[model samples]
Target: MQAAHELSQVQLLSVSIVALGFLYVSWTVTRNLLFSPLRRFPGPKIAALTRWWDIYHTVKCDKFKVIHELHRKHGPVVRVGPNHLSFSSPETFRQVYVKGCATFLKDRDFYANIQPGLGPKYSGLFNYTNHQQSIDERKLLQAKLSPSALRQYELRFLPILDTLVAIMKDKAELDLFAYFKFLMLDAIGDLAFNQSFHQLESGEEHQYVIDFNNAFTLIGLSLKDAYYGLQRVFKYAQTRVDAFLSEEKPKPGTLMEAYLENGKPKPPYTPWYIALSGHGFIVAGSESTSITLTYVVWLLIKHLDIQRRLRLELKNVPPDATGAHLASLPLLDAVIKETLRIYPPAPSAMPRVVPSRGAEMEGINYPPNVRFQLLHRILNFRLR
Candidate 1:
C-alpha cells in the first residue's frame, strides 16, 4: 500500500508539472498576441511572442539586413520584439537622437551584455547606459580630444602615413583593410597612451588586440545564449590587458598619466578602470577609423574621376597641410561625406528606452520601458 501511495504521489507531481508548463505557455501566448501594448504594431507573430526572432538574426550577424527587410515590409516602424520597436524615418530619428527630443535613456538591457564581466563602471562612452555618468567620464578626456588638441595629434599622423606608403610599396598586392587596422592601432596607441602598438612597423598582431577584436565580433553576433561565455572570454582578455598595462610606468602628457594623476583629488581611478578605458579606445577608435578609411579608399579607387579630382585638390595644398587646410577642400570634404553615407562603420540600430513620462514619435505614443531603436543604415541608405 505504501509503494502504491508513493507511485501515486510521483504521478500527481508529473501531472502538476505538465499543467504548469501548459498554463505558462498559454499565458505567454495570450499576453503577447492579445494583451501586449505592441500587439497592434506589424511584425512576425513569433517576434511579438519572444525575443528569439531577434536573437536568431543577431547570431547570424545579419540583424541589420533582417531589420531593414522588416522595415521595408512593415513600413517605418516595426515591432521587432515583445517590447521593442525599430524606426526608419528622419522625423523619428530626430525625435530619438536629437538632443532636445532625446529624453529616452539607452536601453541598459542591450548594453548590459556588451562588455559583460566589467560591470557598469567600466563601460566606456559607446556602451555607457547612464547619461550623466557617460557625460562625466567623457569630460575627463574632452580637452585631450578637442579640436585644438586633435590638430597637434595630426602632426603625428604624417609619419604613420609615410610608413604605410613605404610598407605598401614592398607588396605587389595588399589587403588595405589589414594595413588600415594596423595603422589605426599604432596611431591610437601613440596618441592616447604614448606607446606604439608596433603593428604597422612589425607587421605582427598583438594578442590583446586580437582578443579584443574577437570579443567585439562575439558581441556583434549578439548571441544571448552565449552571453555568459562571451563575458568570461572578454573578462579574461581584459585581465591580461590590465596586467600588461600595470607593468608599464605612466609617462608624462599621456592619457594614462592624466588618468592616474586625476585620481588624487576625487574618485580614484582604479587600475581596472584605466586599463578598460585604454582597451575601449583601442577597440572603438581603431576599428571605426580603420573601417571608415578602408571604405573611403575603396570608394575612391572605384571612382577614378572623383579620385583624380581629390588628388588635384590635395596637390594645391602645402605638403605640410593641416587639418583646417584639409577641411577647407570642398572636393575632399564631399568625397568623405559621400563615403560615410555609403558605408557607415557601424550601420546598426542604436536602441534606447522610452522615458518614464512616455514618448511619442510618428503619431504613435509609447509607454515607458519600451525598447526602440533608430535604424541608422536604413536612414543613410535612403539618402542615396
Candidate 2:
C-alpha cells in the first residue's frame, strides 16, 4: 500500500508539470499565430509590435525622407505597426479619397489629444459624424470662402499686406519667417474673428499667436507616439496648451462666441466643443495658407527667372483691378500648383478603420479593427 501511494503522488506531480507545459505552449502558439502575419508584412520588428519605433525614427531623423524611403522600398503598402498600414498608390488614394468609400474613419486617439479641447459638436469641421456631416460643414463654409467673401476678406487683407510691404520696404535683411507668420496671424484675426491681431500695424507679434503656433506644432509631432497609449506624457503637454488658450478671451460674433451663447443640450454641438473647433479652423486656415506662400517664395528664390516673371505678371495688373484678374495668370498659378504638389501641407497619412464586417484587400482578408492610412504625398508624387 505504501509503494502504491508513492507511485500515485509521482503520477500527480507529472500531470501538473505536463499541464503547465501545455499552457505555455498554447500561449506561444497563440502569439505567433496572431502576430506572425504582421511580421511578414514588412517593417522593422519593433515597429510591427508598437508605433514607438516608427515615431522614434520620425522624430530622430528627417521625418519626410524616412517615411518616403520606407514606402519606396516596401511597395505601395507596408505595415507600420500591428494595426497601421501605409498606402502609397494612386489607386488606393482614389478609392479612399475620391470615391469616399473609406470604411475607416479618423482614429479617436488622434483627436483626444487636442489641448484646449474639441470644438462644438456641430461646428465647422470637428463635429461631423459621417460624410454627410462633412458635406454639411463644407457647404456652410463654402459660402464664406466664395469669390465675394474672399473679395471682402481681401479688402481687409490688402491693408495688412500693405503694412507688411511697408516694413519690408526699407528694412534690409528682415527675418522673412517672422514677418510672414505675423501677416498670417493678422489675416486670421480679421477674417475669422473680425478683430485685429494688430501684428502688422503694431509691428509686434501677438503672444497668443506665438503660443498657439508652438503648441500646435509640438502636438502634431507627438501625435503618433501618443496614439499607442502614451497618454500620460501627451496629456501633460496638452495641459500647457490649455493654459495658453485660457489667457485669450473669445471674440464676440466669432465662432467661439456664437457657440458659447447658443450652445445647449438639444443641438448637435456643445459650447466647449464648438470653441475647440473654431480654434482648429483658425489655426488651419492661417497656417496652411502661410506655409503655401512660404514654399512658393522658396521655389521662386531657386528660380529667379520665375520670380521675375511673376513680378512682371503682377506689375501688368492695374492697381485698381481685382485679385481675380491675377488669378488667371497661368505661370503664376502653375508655380502655386507645383508648390502644392511638392510640399503638401497635409502630408501625413489619413487613417481609416476597417469595417466591422471585415474587408478583402489585395486578395487577403483584413479582419475587423484593422487601421489603414492613405498617404497623400506619396499618391500625388507617384502620379507625377
Which numbered prediction scores highest in TM-score against the true structure? 1
Q: Estimate each model's TM-score.
A: 0.86, 0.74
* Candidate 2 per-residue C-alpha lDDT over 1-384 given as tens digits, one digit per residue, 9 for 90 to 100: 999999999999999999999998676556643655454566555566667766776567465566567788878777776677777766666665566444555565553444433333323365343666766666656656678766756677788888889999978887676678778877776555455678866767666565554444544556543332223323332343343335455333333332333333125544334444545656776767878888888889999999998898888778877788778989888999999988887766557766788766556566676677765567666622
Cα lDDT computed for each candidate against the true fold: 0.75, 0.63
Tell me the TM-score of model 2. Answer: 0.74
Q: Which residue pairs in candidate 1 have backbone atoms (N, alpha carbon, C) closer than 3 angstroms, thus clashing?
A: none
Over 95-206, each residue of candidate 1 has an lDDT whose tens digit, in order, gives 7777523377788778765555444565654567777777777788887777887787777777898899999998899889998999998888766556777898888876
